[model samples]
Target chain A: MPFKDFSKGLVKANPLFVLVLGLCPALAVSTSIENAFGMGLAVIFVLVLSNLIISLLRNMIPKDVRIPCFIVIIATLVTIINITFKAYLPSLTESLGVYLPLITVNCIILGRAEAFASKNPPLRSVLDGVGEGIGFLLAMLLISFIRELLGSGGLNFTILGYKLGEFTIPVFSSMPALFFIMPTGAFLIIGLLLGLFKKTGVLR
Target chain B: MKENVKRVVVLTIIILVSSLSLYAYYTSTEDLIREQETAKLTEEINQIFPDAGRFVQKEDIYYVYSDDGDLIGYAFKATGKGYGGDISILVGVNNDEDLTIRKISVLSQSETPGLGTRITEDEFISQFNNKPIDAIKLRSNNGEIDAITGATISSNAVVNAVYTEYKNKIKSIQR
Candidate 1:
C-alpha cells in the first residue's frame, strides 16, 4: 500500500507532466542539468519534510487556518534548505539564486500539502512526497538534457560543485542553436513534451 | 465562537514554532555564510591584483599592497543595475597617476543566460583592462570599451557603473 502511494507519484500523477504543477522552476532552472538536479533535490527535501509535518499535525491544525499553517511550515522548510545550501554548497546556492527561496511558493509542495498530506497518515504522505518529488526531478532532467545538449551543444556534469565530466558534440558545439537556452526554448520543449506524452498515452 | 478560538490558537502555535526553528537555523549558519562571502571577496581581489600581498578595507574600497609593502593598486566593488538584477564587478586600478584600470572581474550577476550574462566572460571584461578610468564608455559613446553585440544595456551598465564608481572612489583615495 505504501509502495503504491510512492509509485503513483512516479508516473500516474507525475507532478510536472500529469498534475502540471510547479512549472515556474521547471522552466526557469531547466537551462542546465546541474541546476535542474539541484532544484529537484531541494524540492524533494522540502516536499518530503513538509508532507510529514503537515500529515502529523493534520488533526491539530484547524480547517479554517490550515492553508496559512501549511505555508508557515513549507516556508520554514524552504528557509532551512536555503541556509543549508548557502553554507555547504555555495556554488549551487549562487546558481540557484532567487529560485531557491522561491521554493516556498512552489505549487507542488503546497499542492501535495493541501491535496494529499493534510488527510493522509504521515507514512503514506511521505511516500507520496517522495514519489512526486522524484517525478519532478526526472522531468526536469529530461527537459534540461535536451536544452543543454541542443542549446549549448554539450553536457557538462557537476555534482555538489565538483566537475564530474563533460562532452561536446562536434558540429553542435561549434554552432549550437542558442534559442534552446532561452525562455522560448523552455516553453517549446515543455509544450512538445506535453503533446508527446498525450500522444503516447502517458498522460491518461 | 469556540471553533474560532481553536483556529487562532492552532495557527499561532504553528507560526511560533516555525519562527523559532528558522531563527535557530539562521543564527547557527550566519557565521558560515559570512565566512563564505569574505572568502569569495578575497579570492576576487587576489585575482584582480595577483601581485598584492595584503589589502585594507575602508568603506567600500580595498587598498591593495604588494609583498614589499608598497601600495600596488586599489580595488573596489561596483554595482550596476542590469537587465535582470544588480551586476556586481570588482574593478582594480593601477597605482599610476591616471589611475588606469588594472582589470575587472564580475563578482556576481543575474542577467540573461546567454546574452546579457556574457558580461562575465573574458571577451567582454578584458576590454576594461589597461584603459583610463575616464574612458570607460562604449565605442558609440566615443569611449574605449565596446558593448556586447546583443547586450548593449547590460554592457553599458557595467561601463557606466565602473566609470561612476571610479570617479567617486578616486576622490576618497586622493583625500
Candidate 2:
C-alpha cells in the first residue's frame, strides 16, 4: 500500500523529463494543447489496461514468448481506444491522426509491462501505469503550452462543440514565432524544460 | 517434453482469445465508424459548397443542389501521393454550365506537419476559389496558384490531384 510507487513517476522517474520514454508522441503531438490532451488520455488508457492485464497474466505467460504477448495486449487496447475515440471524439481523433493508433507501438506501454508490471501485483501495476501516464501528460502539456502559445500566439480551448474562449496575445498574435511551431520547436522546448528541471533540482 | 507442450498451449490460447475479442469489437464498431466517416464528409461538403441543400451522386461526382432542386454545384474527391502519404482533396466546381473551381478543401492528408500541412490553411486553399480548373498550378510552373513555400511537394500534390480529377470528370460529363 506504499504511495511512493504512484508518485515516483511524476518527477523522480517521469516518463519524459526523467526517464524520457514515449518521446515520439510527446514531441509529435505536443504542437497543440488539445492534441496533447487527447494523446495523453489515450496513452493513459492503453498503459493502465495493458499494465493490469500483463500483471494479471505475468505468471501464466512463458518467458520466451512474453514480448509478443505483451505487444498483442497493448495493441488490442490501443485499437479499441482508437475506434472509440474516432467515433466519440472525432475532432481529437483527426487532430491526433496517426499518433493515436501509433500508441500501439509506443515503448511506454511495453516498457512498463516488461519492467514494472510483470514484477508487481495488478493494483501496483495499475498505479504505476497511471503515474507514468500522468507524468507523460504533464510533460506534454508544458511542452504544448509553450509551443502553441509561442507558435500560434494563442490557445483555443474549444474542441468539438466545447468552447473555452480563445485567448490571443496582443503582439504575439500578429507575428507569432513560426520557429516554435515546427518539429524543431518540440526538441527545443523539451530540452530547455529538462535543463530547467535539472537546474531546479527536479531531475537530479 | 511435457513442459514444451504446455508452453505452446498457453501461447495458442492467448493468441486465440486476443484475435476473437478484437474481431468481435471490430464487427460491433464497424457500422458506427462508417457513420462517423460519412458525417465528417457531409460536414466538409457543407462547408465547401455552402449552398448545397442536397447532394446526388452521378458517376464519381457529387452533384449538389439547393432546396428548390436547382443544381448548386458539384464536388468530388481527388487523391495524389504526397511526401508523407496520399493527400485527398475535396474539389468543388460550379454547376455544369460553369465548370470552374468554386472551392477546394483538403479532405484527408498525412503530409509533413507544419510545413506541408500549410496546404490546408486559408491562405493556401482559398486561392482555389473562382479560378479556372486549368489554372490551379504552382506560380513557379506558370499558373495562377502559388505553392505553399517549403511545401511545394504537398502543394503540388493537391494541385495535381485536383487537376487530374477535374479533367477526367469534365470529359466524362461532356460526353
Candidate 3:
C-alpha cells in the first residue's frame, strides 16, 4: 500500500550511511557475517513491530510525553526479543551477549518511532520499518562480508547447530591480517566504505 | 487539569498492557529456557568428565561417577573479574590427594573480540588439562600456563579464578 514510502529507506535515506544512525551495533557486531545478519534480523523484528504499534498509538500520545511513551514501547519489544532469542537460539544468545539487549537503546528504532511512525498511517509506517530494516540489513551484511572475508579470510553460515558451509583461503586462514576482526578494523572498514560510497555517488 | 488526568490514564493503560503481555510470554517459556540451561550444563559437564556415567550436583559441585559407579572426581565453577566482564571457569579435578585439575573450560566470558576471545579456543583452554594447583598461574608468574597475546588480563582472570576457587573448594571438600 505504501510501496513508494518503503523504497526510499533502502538507499536514499539509509540509516547507516546517509543518516549515519545506529552505528554502535553496526560497528560492534559487524566483525563477522553471522553476527551482522543475526543482528539485522533482530533489528528488523523490533523495527517492524514497534513501528506498527507506535503508528496505531500516534494520535493518542501527547507531544509532551511522546518520547517517554516511545521508549516504553520500544523497551518492551526489545525485552521480549531478548528473552525469545535466549530461549530459542542459545549459541547466538551467547555470542551476541550484551549487544542483544542493548538494542533497547538503538537510536534507529527510537528515531523511526518519533520521526516517521508517529506522523504516518499504520500501513505506511510498516513500510518505512521494512524499508529501513532491509536497508540496515544490507549495509551491515556488506560491511561484515568485507570484514569477515578480508579479516577472517572466510564467510561462515554457521547458526544454531547448522552449518550451510564455509569457504576459506588456506594461507589467509593460517596467517590472517587479524586487524579486520578487531575493534579498530570496524572503524577502518566503515570509514573506507563510507568514503567510497561518497566518491562513487552511492551516497551524497 | 482535565488534560493531565487523561494523559496519566492513557500512559497507565499502556504500561499495564505491556507488562501483562510480557508476563504471559514469560509464563509460557520459562520452563523451556530452564530446560535449555540444564541441557547446556550437562553437555559442558560431560565434556569435562569423559568417562562420567551420571552426575549428581550439590551446592554447585558436580560429583561425577564412572560407569561401574566409582567416583571419578568432582567439578565446580569459579568466577573472576575479566577484562570485558566476569569470566566463569569450570574446573574438573581427579579424585587424587592433590585434587589436581583434570581439565578446565572457560564457561563464559565477555572479553574483547579477536584477542581475548581466543582464550576460548582449544589451544588456550587445553593448557590447563591435568595441571596441579600450583601450575594454574601464568608462565610469567612462574607457572606453566601461557597467556594469550593481547589478552593477558583475560588469561590471568581465568587462571586466578580456578586457582583460588580450587584451593577453597578442595579445602572444604576435605573437611
Candidate 4:
C-alpha cells in the first residue's frame, strides 16, 4: 500500500490544519485535556469503523443510494457509541453529552469514508482512517494542553481512581486568566494557532 | 455474466459479515453499559450524601437512606431553559425537605463558559447545600441566593429549576 495516502493526512491534508473538518468539537471540547482526549478517542472509533464499513460495502451501494447508505451506517455506529458511553463511561459521557451524537455530522469521518475509503482498498482505507484520526487527535490535544494550563492554571485530573497531580505553577494558579476558558478564547486560540502553523511552514 | 454474479455474491457476504459482527459486539456490552450508568448515579449520590447506605429511584427521583435505613434525603434532577440552552442539575433535599445538595452536577448546559458556567462552581453550589427550601429563589427576586454576575439568566435558571422540582418532589416524599 502506498504510504503517501496515510502521510498526506498528517500535514498536507491535515484534518484541522488543512482540511478544517470537525471544527465545532475542536473549539468546544478543547477547554480541558480530559475532554479533548475523550473526544479524540470517540472520533477515532467513529472514523475507523465508518471507513471500514464504507470500504467493505463500496461496490454494492448504488450510486443513488450511497449517501443515504453511508448516513445510516455512520448514524448507527454513532448511536451505539453514544448509548454505550451513556451506560459505561458515564462521567465522560456526561461531560461529552450531545457532542457524542454530533459525531454523525463531524464532516471528517463522513468526508473520509466517502472520498477516500469508497475508492481505496480496505487496508489503505484503514490506514487513512488511522492517520486522519491521529492528526485530529494531535491538533486537539495541542490546543487543549495550552487551554487547560493557561485557562485553569493546572493540569489536575483523575481517571478511574488514578491520581494526576495538580500541576499548578505559582503565579498562574492564584489568578488564572478567566478569558482563556471562554468561547471567545477558543476562537482566538484556534485563529492564532492557525496563523502560527502557517507562519512556521507547518501547514504549507 | 458469471464474473458479475461472483462480484455481487462476494459483496453481499462482506456486508453480512460486518453487520453480524457489530450486532454481536453491541449485545454483549449492553449489560455492562447499564451497570456503569447506575454506578455513576450512585457515586454522585454518595458525593452528596456520603453516608447514604441505600436508595430508591422512582420516576427519575432518588430517595437516599442512611446505613440504618432511615430516610436521609431525597434527590431529583432539575432542568431549565437557560440563555444558551437547557441546563440540567441534580437536586438533593435532606430529611427536613431542605436541600442537602449532594452536588449540583451540570448534566447539560450551553451557557457562556466562564461567566454563566460558574454556577457549577463549589462557591456557588455549596451555598445551596444546607439552605432552606423556601429561600431558594435568586437574590434578584428578593431571595437569599446570589446570582453569578453576567449570568443572571443562567443562575436564575438553576435556581428556578431547583425550586420548581423541590416543590413537586417534596410533596411525593412527604406522603
Candidate 5:
C-alpha cells in the first residue's frame, strides 16, 4: 500500500525538513542556487549508490557490525565521486571541498540504508533513495535561489556549460544585503522558508 | 547440514566480491586520478600566464617561459594560516617589479561563509592584479585593498599573505 518504501522519503519522512539530518553542508553551501545544486547532486550520488550496494549485500552484513560496514561503503562511494568530479568537474569539486567527504555521515545515506533499504526489496530501496535525493535537491535549490538573488543582487552562471543571463535586482544590486550571504543568512532563509511552507500548507 | 554450510559460503562470497570490486576500481582509477590532478595545476598556470607557452619548475617555484623561450616571470604558491584553514595563493612577479598576482585561490579555509569566502571573489582578487609589490595591504592600513566588511580575519589573511610573500621573495631574488 505504501509502495514498499520509495514513497516515504518524499515528504512524510523528508531528510532535510522532516528528519533534520545533515545540517552542516545544508547551511554551509546553501548560499547560492548553484552551490546548493552541486551539493545536492553530490549527496544524491552518494545516497543512491550507497543504498543500492547496502541493500544488495544486506544479508551478508552482520547486525552488530552493520553500522561500520555502511560507513565504509558510503565513504568509498563518496571518494569515487569526489575523484571523478575533480577530474571532470573541477570547479564544482573545488567548491564542494570537505563537504563531499562529509557526505559519508550525512545521515541521509545511512538513514536510508537502515530505515528503508534493510527492510525493503533492493529495487524499492533504490527508488526510495532516488525520491529522497530529488526531495533534497529541490529543497536546496529553492532556498539557494532566493538567497543568491537577494544577497548577491544577481545570479550569474552557466549550468552544464550553458549560460544563464546574469540575474540582478536593481535595488539589491545597488545595496546588496550583506547578511543574506552570511552564515546567519542561511539560517534566516531556511527558517523563514520553512515557516512559509508550513503557513501555506506546502509541508503539511 | 549441507544447506547451512552453503549459506555460509554464499555470504562469504558476497563479502569477497564487494571488497574486490571496490579495490579493482580504486587501483585502476588511481593513475588517471593523478593525471587529472596534474592537469588541474597546469590549467591554473596557463590562466595565470595567458602568454606563457610553457614553464619549468625549480624547487617549489614555477618559472613561466614564453614561446620564444624568454623568461616571462616567476610564479610560486604561498600558504598562509587563515581564519578557517590554509589560504594558498599563487604569486607571480614580472621583471619590472610589477606583480600580476596570477591568482589568489583559497585551497582550504573555514572562515564564516559568505563573509570570509568573499575574499576569493574577483572583486577582492582584482585588487592584486598588476598591483605594485609594495602596495599590498588593507586600505584601512593605508593600502589599496578593501576589506570585506565583518570578514576582517579572511581579508587580512589574503593581505598578509601577499605582503609577507612579496617581501620574502624580493629578498630571495635580490640575493
Candidate 6:
C-alpha cells in the first residue's frame, strides 16, 4: 500500500503530463538538460519537505487559514533552497533567476499540500511527494533532452557546475535547428508531447 | 468564537516558526554567498588583466596594479539592455592618455543563441582591444567597432554600454 502511494506518481499521477500541473517551470527551464535537472532537483527538495511538514501539522492547521499556512511553509522552503543555491551553486542560481523564487506559487507543491499531504499521514504524504517530484524530474529530462539535442545540436553534462562530458552530433552540430531553443520551441514541443500522451492513452 | 481563536493562534505560530528558521538559515549562509560573488569578480578581473596584481575598488571602478605594485589600468563593468536580457561586460582600459581599451570579456549575457551570442566571440570582442574609448561606437555611427552581421542589437548593446559606462566612470579614474 505504501509502495503503491509512491509508484502511482511515477506514471499514473505524473504531475507534468497526467495531472498537467506546474508547466511554467517546465516550459521555462527545459531549455537545457542541465537546467532542467537543476530545477527538477530544487522542486523535489521543496515538494518532499513541504509535504512532510504540512502532513505533520495538518491537525494543528485550521481549515480556515490552511492555505496561508501552506503558502508560508512552501515559501520558506523555497527561500532556503534559493539561499543554498546562491551560496554553493552560483551559476545555477544565475540561470534559474526569477523562476527559482516563483516555485513558491507552483501549483504542484501547493496542490499536493492541499490535496494529499493535508489529508494523509506523514509517511504517506512523503511518499506521494517523492513519487510526484521524481515524475516531474523525469518529464523535465525528457523534454530538455529533445530540446537541447535538437536546438544546440549537442549535449553537455554538468553536475554542481562541473563538466562531466559533452558531444556534438556530426551534421546537426554544423546546421542545427535554432528554433528548438526558443520559447516558441518550448511551447510547440510541450503541446506535441501532450497530444502524443493523450493519443496513446498515457494521459487518459 | 472559540474556533476563530484556534485559527488565529495556529496561523500565528506557523508564521513565527517559519520566519525564525528562515532567518537562521540566511544568517548562516550570508558569508558564503558573499564570498562566492567576490571570488567570481576577482576571477573576471584577472581574465581582463592577466598580469594584474592587486585591484582597488573606488565607487564602481577597479584600479588594476602590476606585479611591482605600479598602477596598470582601470577595469569596470558595463551593463546594457540586450535582446534577451541585461548584458554585462568587464572592460579593461590601459592607463594611457587616451585610455585605450586593453581587453574586454563578457561577464554574463542572455542573448539569442548562435546569433546574439556571437558577441562573446573574439572576432567581435577583439575589435574593442587597443581602440580609443571614443571609438567604441559601431562603424555605422562613424566609430571603429563593427556590428555583428546578424546580431546588430546585441553588438550595439555591448558597444553602447561600454561607451556610456566609460564616459560615466572616466572622471573618477582621472581624479
True contacts kept of each: 0.86, 0.50, 0.40, 0.24, 0.12, 0.90
Could you give candidate 3's per-residue lDDT for residues A17-130 as a string of tens digits? 878899999999998878888899999999999999999999998888888888889989998998898789888888788899898899999999999999999999999999
What are the models' TM-scores?
A: 0.95, 0.89, 0.93, 0.83, 0.82, 0.97
Q: For candidate 6, write residues B52-107 as lDDT tens digits.
A: 89899989889999899989999999999999999999999998878999999998
List residue ranges in candidate 2 displaced over 4 A: A158-161, B68-71, B80-86, B109-124, B138-142, B146-157
- Candidate 6 per-residue C-alpha lDDT over A49-94 given as tens digits, one digit per residue, 9 for 90 to 100: 9999999999989998999999999999999999999999999998
Per-residue lDDT, model 2, residue B41, is 76
Best by TM-score: 6
In order of TM-score, best first, we have 6, 1, 3, 2, 4, 5
TM-score of 3: 0.93
True contacts kept of 1: 0.86
| Tens digits of per-residue lDDT for model 2, A97-171 | 889889998988888999999999999999999999998888888899899899888987754447767898997
Residue-wise C-alpha lDDT for candidate 4, range A8-27, written one tens digit per residue: 77787889878889899998
Estimate the Cα RMSD of every predicted model relative to the unseen true structure: 1.7, 2.7, 2.1, 3.9, 4.0, 1.3
* Candidate 5 lDDT by residue in tens digits, A9-57: 6776677777777777888888777778888888888888888888888
How well does chain A score by TM in each candidate? Answer: 0.98, 0.95, 0.96, 0.93, 0.91, 0.97
Runs in model 5 lying further than 4 Å from the true structure: A1-4, A157-162, A198-201, B1-23, B81-86, B96-132, B138-155, B169-175
lDDT for each residue of candidate 2 in B103-147, tens digit (9 for 90 to 100): 999977877655888898999999999898768888887889998
lDDT of 2 at B17: 86
| Candidate 5 per-residue C-alpha lDDT over B1-175 given as tens digits, one digit per residue, 9 for 90 to 100 | 7656656665566557657776887788788778887787777777777888887777667788899998877777777777777888877766454544555554456565556778878888788777776567899888888888888888898889877877777655531
- DockQ of structure 3: 0.56
TM-score of 5: 0.82
Q: Judged by DockQ cut-offs, is candidate 4 incorrect, acceptable, medium or high?
A: acceptable
- Report the Cα interface RMSD of each model, rounded to 1 decimal: 1.3, 2.3, 1.7, 5.3, 4.6, 0.9
DockQ of every candidate structure: 0.76, 0.52, 0.56, 0.29, 0.28, 0.86
Please give the RMSD of candidate 5 to the true structure: 4.0
Write model 1 residue lDDT over A1-204, tens digit each, in one string.
Answer: 899899998888999989999999999999999999999999999999999999999999888899999999999999999999988888899999999999999999999999999999999999999999999999999999999999888999986688899999997686778798988999999999988998998656
* Residue A92, model 5, lDDT: 81
